[model samples]
Target: MANKTAPDSPPGSAGGTPTRRRSERSRRAILDASLALVGEVGYDKLTIEGIASRAGVGKQTIYRWWPSKAAVLLDAFTADVDEYSAQGLPDTGDLAADLKLVLRATADEFNDPAFQAPYRALAVAGANDAELSRAFVDRLLEPGIRVYVDRLRAAQEAGEVAADVDTRVAAEMLLSPFSQRWLMRTGELTYDYVDTLVDLVLRGLRPGS
Candidate 1:
């Protein structure tokens, strides 16, 4: 009788399940190593070899999944951000107060010592690398912005925000100043500063204003 086997199965295995499980483990290890290494050595010194060594995988393994260390770092950062943003923005039925809470929390994260180096490295590198910049905006920044947009839309439905207000633009107006101040170092990022921004933005967006 002829031997029976599946064409796609790995040699000496029943199926590809073990291979897929191993691949997922390697992927998680690579992402974690990238995040840890970026924090330890900063982005300038981070390399595929370093990530491969820390991850206990071949450099080819990382190359197979990501083109460069920047791509790896971006993926790692996106994973981290996604974990935090899984809950979306807060909506407490008071638009101004909720905005203040969220913005102040964001300010705190931006000012965090542990968060500064890796974030600044990505931001600075993205400034010069157009492809990475676009990826950063598309994969990381825009999703977070959409959360803010969702909260604003909720507010609009509740009569806290004007029905005519464009949530996307309004979200940007609410967030852009805080981001600029943090990224440019042009102004202090403080809770009071974010509160003022929230106030000014809400003043313009309020119904019948």
Candidate 2:
């Protein structure tokens, strides 16, 4: 058979361009490195140089995608939360049960040692950095909050929640207490605590409470 050269492939036709694949790998490495380093060194001690070194990428590469170490950590944290939020709040037709289930899961996540270090670091960093604070609220916090809002809206339509209830406020009410407790270390984030929050919030949102 005669030797022949194959035609050039399009950017995303089969396996994507080598540059695109390499960029994605670099992005994943950067995000993973940021998370791991934050957990290991704490965010105060974390730097773009540290992330670049850990990711095996140039500092310029990280700067090309994120403005600061806080921004990198924000992206990393958002990526981790995206995996869980993708499933959203459960809708078992019983709003109280679903709220308790999700809240308890949240308590468990907050209680986990591996999750605590990086999460607390992110929380503290967001408090000091205005841009990072906005990004964290916009990217990570609001989306997670919306999951609750959505579930509540579903309950409203199902006649489980009162029609007059403000789902957004109700969602915040359900979440803010646990968040305060978890972030401030004011109290234990136990399943019982979250279940109580669920019951209390549900009682207020019910038709005749």
Candidate 3:
């Protein structure tokens, strides 16, 4: 199998000893390997040894950085998520356009097969595992989601959304449609679906407007 790193990635990412860029590079390679492999092989089959092998790093290296395969995967997810911040909705001052962009980006992430494996495995793991569920909620779910909360708040402040809008609830109204569909396979996630979600969300938030 080819051992080449994915093209266009920066020379690793942040969060390691400042002196050694190599360590960061190694970590990112392992992470990319984990995500790619997990997508190809279910989470149940993921292994620290496998990640180390695929990443072209020592098994001891992975062990040095993380306690387990799960820990490695967690770091991988954390390290990669900043890349998604770019997808955070831009405020073009058009609430409808802004909301549509945000939801579409969200749906796009949900549709990634590579992202889905770990997400699905984690969701299933979460049900019987409170600590995992809480960690998943706090670490994985909340940060990116609060961007929607903030955007809705901006809309309410600008009177684009009703004064009575509950930002938390309103954010959910925008988010849950995609989550429900993706998790339940209830419907396909597409640009058209997200646009419809945006419409429904706006219709609910606009008070007699």
Candidate 4:
């Protein structure tokens, strides 16, 4: 098997640091190549050899870092996502406002051509491949969804949401509608639409008097 790291650099010498830097650069190039190829050729046609060729690295270099094409795609998607949402979830102490803020940002991301192509391709591919589906959900989807779970828990603790509500289900209320519209292209994902979803969720889940 290929090694992801360069042959061990001197344990603590400047001479070895450049080798590690080159390895890191190679890894990033592989990811960028994967993203570009997925957009150019779609997920089904993407291959390790193609990625290696595009990245200008040996196949061993990719295999050393990632186990499969799905793994590479998932990493590329999340890395791109990190660039856009590096701040993490919002927490302004108001659940409705925070939900709206996050959803609007998400909506904008979905609408962005750079994000949409790969995301839509992965979503479609995951539907048929169980391994890719698992990686996609575990690495990408659930982490994004967990933002809502955390925010809802905060709301419950703040006495803004009902203590008995199932946050897992509640989180879906915010995400599902938007996802449906986005995937189906049935309606506009405007700020008003997301604001309404937040209002509906808060009104339905708020603690009773």
For 68-141, candidate 2 gives per-residue lDDT tens digits of: 78767877787767876788788999999888887787788889888888888888877888877888899998
lDDT of 1 by residue, 42-104 (tens): 777899999999999888778777878987888888876676578887777988888898888
lDDT of 4 by residue, 26-127 (tens): 777888898888877888999999999999999877776677898888877787455544566677888888888878988898888877787778888999
lDDT of each: 0.82, 0.81, 0.75, 0.80
Q: What is the lDDT of candidate 1?
A: 0.82
Model 3: weakest 10-residue lDDT segment is 1-10
- Which whole-number lDDT from 0 to 100 does residue 122 have in model 1? 84
- What TM-score does structure 4 among the candidates reach? 0.84
Off by over 4 Å in 2: 1-19, 83-86
| Alpha-carbon TM-score of each model against the true structure | 0.81, 0.84, 0.83, 0.84
- Model 2 residue 125 distance off true place after TM-score fit, in angstroms: 1.7
RMSD of each: 5.9, 6.0, 5.7, 4.3
Worst 10-residue lDDT window, candidate 4? 7-16
The weakest ten consecutive residues by lDDT in model 1 span: 1-10
Please give the distance, in angstroms, between residue 184's alpha carbon in candidate 1 and its true position after superposition: 0.9
